[model samples]
Target: MRIPLYALLLCSVPFMVHAQSETDSVHHSYTLSTVNYTIAGQRYQKNYTRSRELQQSTDRLLERIPGVTMIRRGNFAMEPTLRGLSAAQINMTIDGMQLFGACTDRMDPISSYVEPNNMERIQLGFSPNGEQHNASVGGGLNFSLKQAQTGAAKVWSGLAGAGYETNASATQTIAALQYSRSRFAISANGVWRRAGNYTAGKGQEINFSQYNKWNLGLSAVYLLKPNQQLRVDYLQDEGYNIGYPALTMDVSFAKAKIGSASYIYTPTGMKLKSWESKVYYNYIDHAMDDTKRPAWQVPIHMDMPGTSQTMGLYSRAKWYYTNHFLEAQFTAYSNRLHAEMTMYPKNAAEMFMLTLPDVQRTVYGIDLKDKIYLGQDWTLSPSLTVNYVQSDIYTELGKETLSSLFTGSLDRKNLIWNAGLNAEKHINGRWTLFGQLSRGARSASAQELYAFYLFNRMDNFDYIGNKDLKQETSVNASLGMSYHQHRLHIQPQLFVYRFSNYIVGQRKQGYSTMTIGASGVKQYVNIPDALLYGGELYATYRPWDKWYIQSTNSISIGQDNAGNALPLIPPFKSINRIEYTPSKYGFYAESISQSRQDRVSTAVYGERASAGFTIFNVGAGRNFAIGKNTLNVHAAVYNILDKQYYEHLDILKLYRPGRNLALNLSLTF
Candidate 1:
């Protein structure tokens, strides 16, 4: 693994001389084209998706990106983390649309509502480059949905596809159709997927790992005149019998509905280069129970129900000139969430408990970005954002517990802002160096603000929210260098952040008055100061004409944190691959390795330790053409070595899937 990785890195330096032009971009036609490898400002008109990638979940695909980690509670909706930050710290949206997960346990991530087949592309903006999402403190991940294209051909077009995997007995089906004419276009896509229990590397079956899901999307586009256009989109997704063995309960049913209308004006006039405005709304409902898994047991029978309603609006405008560009945006959004868990005595019919009620978070924000070119070798970019956030916990029925503790109806208001600057210099014809400095802030999540007597499995503790908690803030800086050549691209960067009023789970000293079965009670508390620092190296190369190799290694550490280490900090990890794709066919072999995660927070947070393991994977595929359609085929075996292991990121600490084979076939015109 090291040999191929080093070869791919060392032999391509000379080839990079011809690609010096990559350091500068006007159209930004090529963004991070690869699956999981991207840097700030990476922009591409057409994204690349490997054949094998189609068979993997969206969360798994995102793992390929450096500094990105996935917290795997189950097979779906893996929580994504970057640079030791996750959840609301990283703004996640679909084409500028906001969504909130209904599950307090985080069983359903926003990404779960979007299927891979419905995605046109994904762009993640890091610090100093996230003008698109000003509220983000760490980064922003944006999913661009497939839309009806204007000026389409007279004939109708459609595609159909199916896929399967063995480890979980999973199956996938997909279909899409589109029609376009002189001025209007319409498109629709549907997807269905189902899976059973997944087998581990040691042949053990993890309960609550099965799920069935489906989604449908409809879109319409009209060319108003010239470069002006209008578009509308609607999407709905449903999941049934989703299992979460790691959590206290399993999800029985969940559904999401989202709609958006946007107007885009990109006139050739050039003075007002572009203007975009959108209005979007999304809703989610989820229900969970322990009955989904017969083997699962708890002291008391419980039912969990959750729902969220969100409305948002955004508009952006860019003015361009010869050597300078300026842009500004306005955004406002509000989300209301009602999540409650009720416990029923197994023997007594009259006793039940109400947990978590009346939580809402609303935000309004604006941002600006400026880019200036210095001579022919330097570029300067700067951005700023400000937001007003409000949190409310209304106990109109007097049924909630936290309201009594806080003495009255809970209300909190905060005004926050973030600013960043990035500078880049082109060095001759082979190297480029960049630097970034930013100060960002994030408002507390709904749970952090007002959850009442919530049970947390990760630390085996009952959690209560803090109404007076301050918003978390961070000051960060990073430096990086990039080397580009004909056959290789290598980029390495190091970053550090100092957090103020960092919110963490602090173990309550006494348990006498705490909820039952609680090892300890945890309350949101402010740690005066904490620090997180990390770095990652990404490299890709083509040693020969037909062979390509890629590798990434990342590590991060947290200090002055709540535990021995930052909660869920990933260990030293690497993914190395060698592949050959000459024509319509391709073949590849890969190795994934990780170091032992001994820096556990168990002493402070009662988190458990995790052992490390390595896994081998391989795949091959080919495509064929018939009539007017093209058929693409792919097959792969995961965990070829069948090594027994589980990731530290799994909050439930469940064993990862072992050896499994998958096959995919699709056709398109």
Candidate 2:
């Protein structure tokens, strides 16, 4: 029998590991434990505090996680997928607030609204017991915002930074300032970025790849009492002249405004450990057009505009009992979305239609969880959530648009629930084992249930939604092991999911196309069953006091009940790195590799095979101290081999950026 790579590494190295339980106290600035695992209650944090990471985009920093992959349409905004699941299958949030994208083509994901400088850390929950905020089977990702800090030694502190990249001729400038006292704290930050067209491998300039954007954030906190505080936050982001070479149209502008307020209380020497209540609102606007394309390239010109607005609130409390920890939360939200398109044919009258129509959705949910201690070395956690959802077409034009396709009521409602159980056993001080089993279900999204004549650039097909589609559900199971010795740490995890009423877009034969020079139409449909399985392995070894080596590997497999490959599934990929660090300076070398994927879903998804490739990168950094202030400089060269390649998930098979040098400098006082 052939042994797996993870198993081989497990046998060859002695490891050390650590796990978190519900009883542990939460930190003000959450940081990942030394060992990062996919088990229940596992938290992972990137080194975003470093100067190198502070200069990168939010999307680029997210790609470093183990089970995450990015779907790129351009250099600007990229959508993220967790364990091969995208779109509505996963729940994404900012500071525990619900937000949705305005673009019908998914050019503006929620992550695009927050810059890296405004973020503190990211929290991920994969197990049903871990994620009780929403009805989702794939998992949940939450971006934590940076807040003002009180009781600091200095009355004021801030950082200023600038960066440049050769490949895209991109320039970036960022600034942050904070003021703190015994009872009050306030912070403000801003970022600006501009880029020209980028060059692909072999110095081929990729046209229509330029973009410009800016972001601003402000936060304030006031201490009402020794154990009580009030906080408020606001953020604004805007983008203009954004180009997408992979698609037929480019975005003229995209903008978002978000604001929130919260109250937090911590009780000492009581069963009620902590309580928090928060309310938030957000708005998004996006517009795109094909006027940038040449006359011959675009037989007809079209304009598309979309908007989304949301308001939400949540309250959570934690309590400690004898040998048990208990928690409960209540959440409610309302959202409205509208999208429309107008096409102008040469020497003909203008035609208009509702792409997404005017749709309204409201949701309310409650969650309860408990962690029981079964002695000193074992623990069990159980969680449950109940949610009520109501959806309707709120406009006469939307009702009229969908009336031609379906002969049913325009109102939809559903009650959904999710439950999960997890267990952990610690055999010794250095060895641990964990397992989880859970089931979850989610209602269809607005786009999936009521969209009309929505064109998909990936498959070159137009799509219509089905209002009568059934809810999708999944059953999940996972197991993991961790080991830690003196200088080595290793973790391996495996997971599998069985889905019911899986949703997909099926081709409708003999149907006319809506877009110019497009393929036939496709409609959303539910299949009987589908399966997804994946695994991840992480290892780090310290050969000497100043040198460290690390390896991360992940693989995913997806198939339908009929033994057909699923669309957009990524192949085996690995990242290896070596680093040497002394007190004030550091140097690193990294390699990223992916295996060739031959599995193609040509019939339904229009997928093609992709070849494997590898790339190398190197970087170094140094910090200089002058008085009480500090200055840092970092530089790196990426894609040193200049290989022409694209990942399996890259839509339209656009080649990634080629060799480039990046430099960043920052000063803190």
Candidate 3:
């Protein structure tokens, strides 16, 4: 029986209550949450203290956006599910551009490539299909890079910081430098992270060791015309890594090189009030090395290389009239992927093996949206979008036939659609209500159709893709209320999702071959029936000018035909934070709690019951001025009591790691 991830969280609630306490009082210069929205009517933001040592990436930053929940798998990249639709259903874009992650495990999302500190803001549309960005389908995330002062001349700035965490034996460092001149700007940022083996709650030392990574990026922007600009960027990451709880070989030496250039044009006068056009291209080359040991008399090491190239163009036209605001956009995108594998055969009769597959794909989309004000504090928004995709895939088994299995190439086409409507009303002087309904559909990605590989991290299992997978469709609706008082801001939202052709995993009969227990082969299959419902409460209160507190609670329930809770449907969770700022310094304490859940899905190996525990975090920082320099220093301690707990989404739970203390320090000029 599969155990639900949430059940463990619920069980930990009792412990959570005991770990929280009130700390010192100070005044904060400004709350990061309040700085996000310029227009207060329809925006929400959450902030993670710099002392938390959250991963520096766009995807991690999305967690600060209201109405979004991030289900993390590891330090790698998080998978986002908006209103019960995730993966390809969620549109992820960076700096107005889209790129595909090359990892077959979806380990490296485009968001993972962007450093969080490099971003000015991350925005999300609560209603799926409300707006279109490039080839986005269900929901859209926009990553905006930080910009220098509007008219500053020859400005220079930089920041440096480092953090250490006991859990997962993690340590990291970050630094950034920037320069801005009239009509020109340049910036560079980088991060280095490393961790040793970690011991779980059971006192088992998981092999999660020696995971070292480094990434560096450089960007430049130039204004060619008053209304036009050009930007170019380059990024690279090199690392040697290992995933805990892996039954076989650890992954090592992964590397990537990326580059992109974009031209953006905005004309002040046109048929529409304004029009903006953009085009960009990016390339990624990835490779990894692993040594398989299970089921073999001796170690079998191998190497693999994968590459992806992408190009895209998008444009938007905006029109404004007396009571109506309208906008339309079109996008074109294409990508190509190539991969090769090299290995050693154990038997003298057998020779080295290799598998290669080449894939190419293209997509086109058009979308339209309108907002109308009907008086009486009433407003309405409607949107529609359509998209199409085509792909060609081919594969070659170097040895002609390793297991005498038959395979064939595939060529397919797909069409997708989305529509949504939103209505809002101001009920009173301090309260407002809103409702939204949206329907979205997305076609399967190329990796879902043709991928076939051994995922050693999950227990030396082979994952096979199915070509017959169907498009997934979902309808979502939400009702919410917002309140603003002199010292508080609050929003509560409830939502439900009805799905058709939802995709899930199913075990295949007779395909059960494993070195461990009776682990059958599970493949992605389409489910015709599915439903999900949930609600969230979020608020920020400033009881006094010197103290601020924020709280958020969320719960979601999902089920299939049997009406059993879906496995890993994030259990009820809450986050509370109290912060105090003193002129140029800040101090904060935060607690996150999870309720235990018991939902389980198909049989999975090493799947066991999970328990919960509460973690305490406290930190303080201050900025000081030297004669000619500005410097800042901060420090924090995580898992204050050194609690032993399990993260529902932590893929290393099989080893049961415990939390450890962490510290951070920073300098800025």
Q: What is the total number of backbone clashes in candidate 1? A: 9
Please give the ranking of all candidate structures by TM-score, highest first, separated by commas: 2, 1, 3
Give one digit per residue, the lDDT tens place, for model 1 in 331-424.
8888878877666776677444445566666777788888888887788878789988877755564235564657754778889899888787
Roughly what TM-score does model 3 have, to 2 decimal places?
0.83
lDDT of residue 577 for candidate 2: 80
**Candidate 2 lDDT, tens digit per residue, 1-669?**
110110111111112123333221110122222222333334322231244455678877666667777888888898888778888888888888988999999999988998878877666676544542678877777777889998988999998999999999999998989999999999999999999999988898888899999999999999999789999999999999999988889999999999999999999999999999998989999999877778877888899999998888899999899998998998888888999999998899999999998998888888888888889888787889888888898889999999988897978999988898878887886787877788888899999999898888888889999888899999988888777776776878899989999998898887788888788899998999999999988777779977778887888899987888898888998888887777777788888888998887787687888899998888888788978988878888889888788888888989989998988888888
* lDDT per residue (tens digit) for residues 127-169 in model 3: 4564226333346665555443323543887777887777666
State the TM-score for model 1: 0.92
Tell me the alpha-carbon RMSD of every candidate. Answer: 6.6, 6.5, 7.7
Mark the regions of model 1 whose C-alpha exceeds 4 Å error after superposition: 1-52, 128-132, 350-354, 398-400, 511-516, 561-563
Q: Which consecutive 10 residues in model 1 have the weakest lDDT in total? A: 1-10
Pick the TM-score winner.
2
Compute each candidate's TM-score over C-alphas. 0.92, 0.94, 0.83
| Model 2 worst lDDT window (10 residues) | 3-12
List per-prediction Cα lDDT, in the order shown. Answer: 0.74, 0.80, 0.59
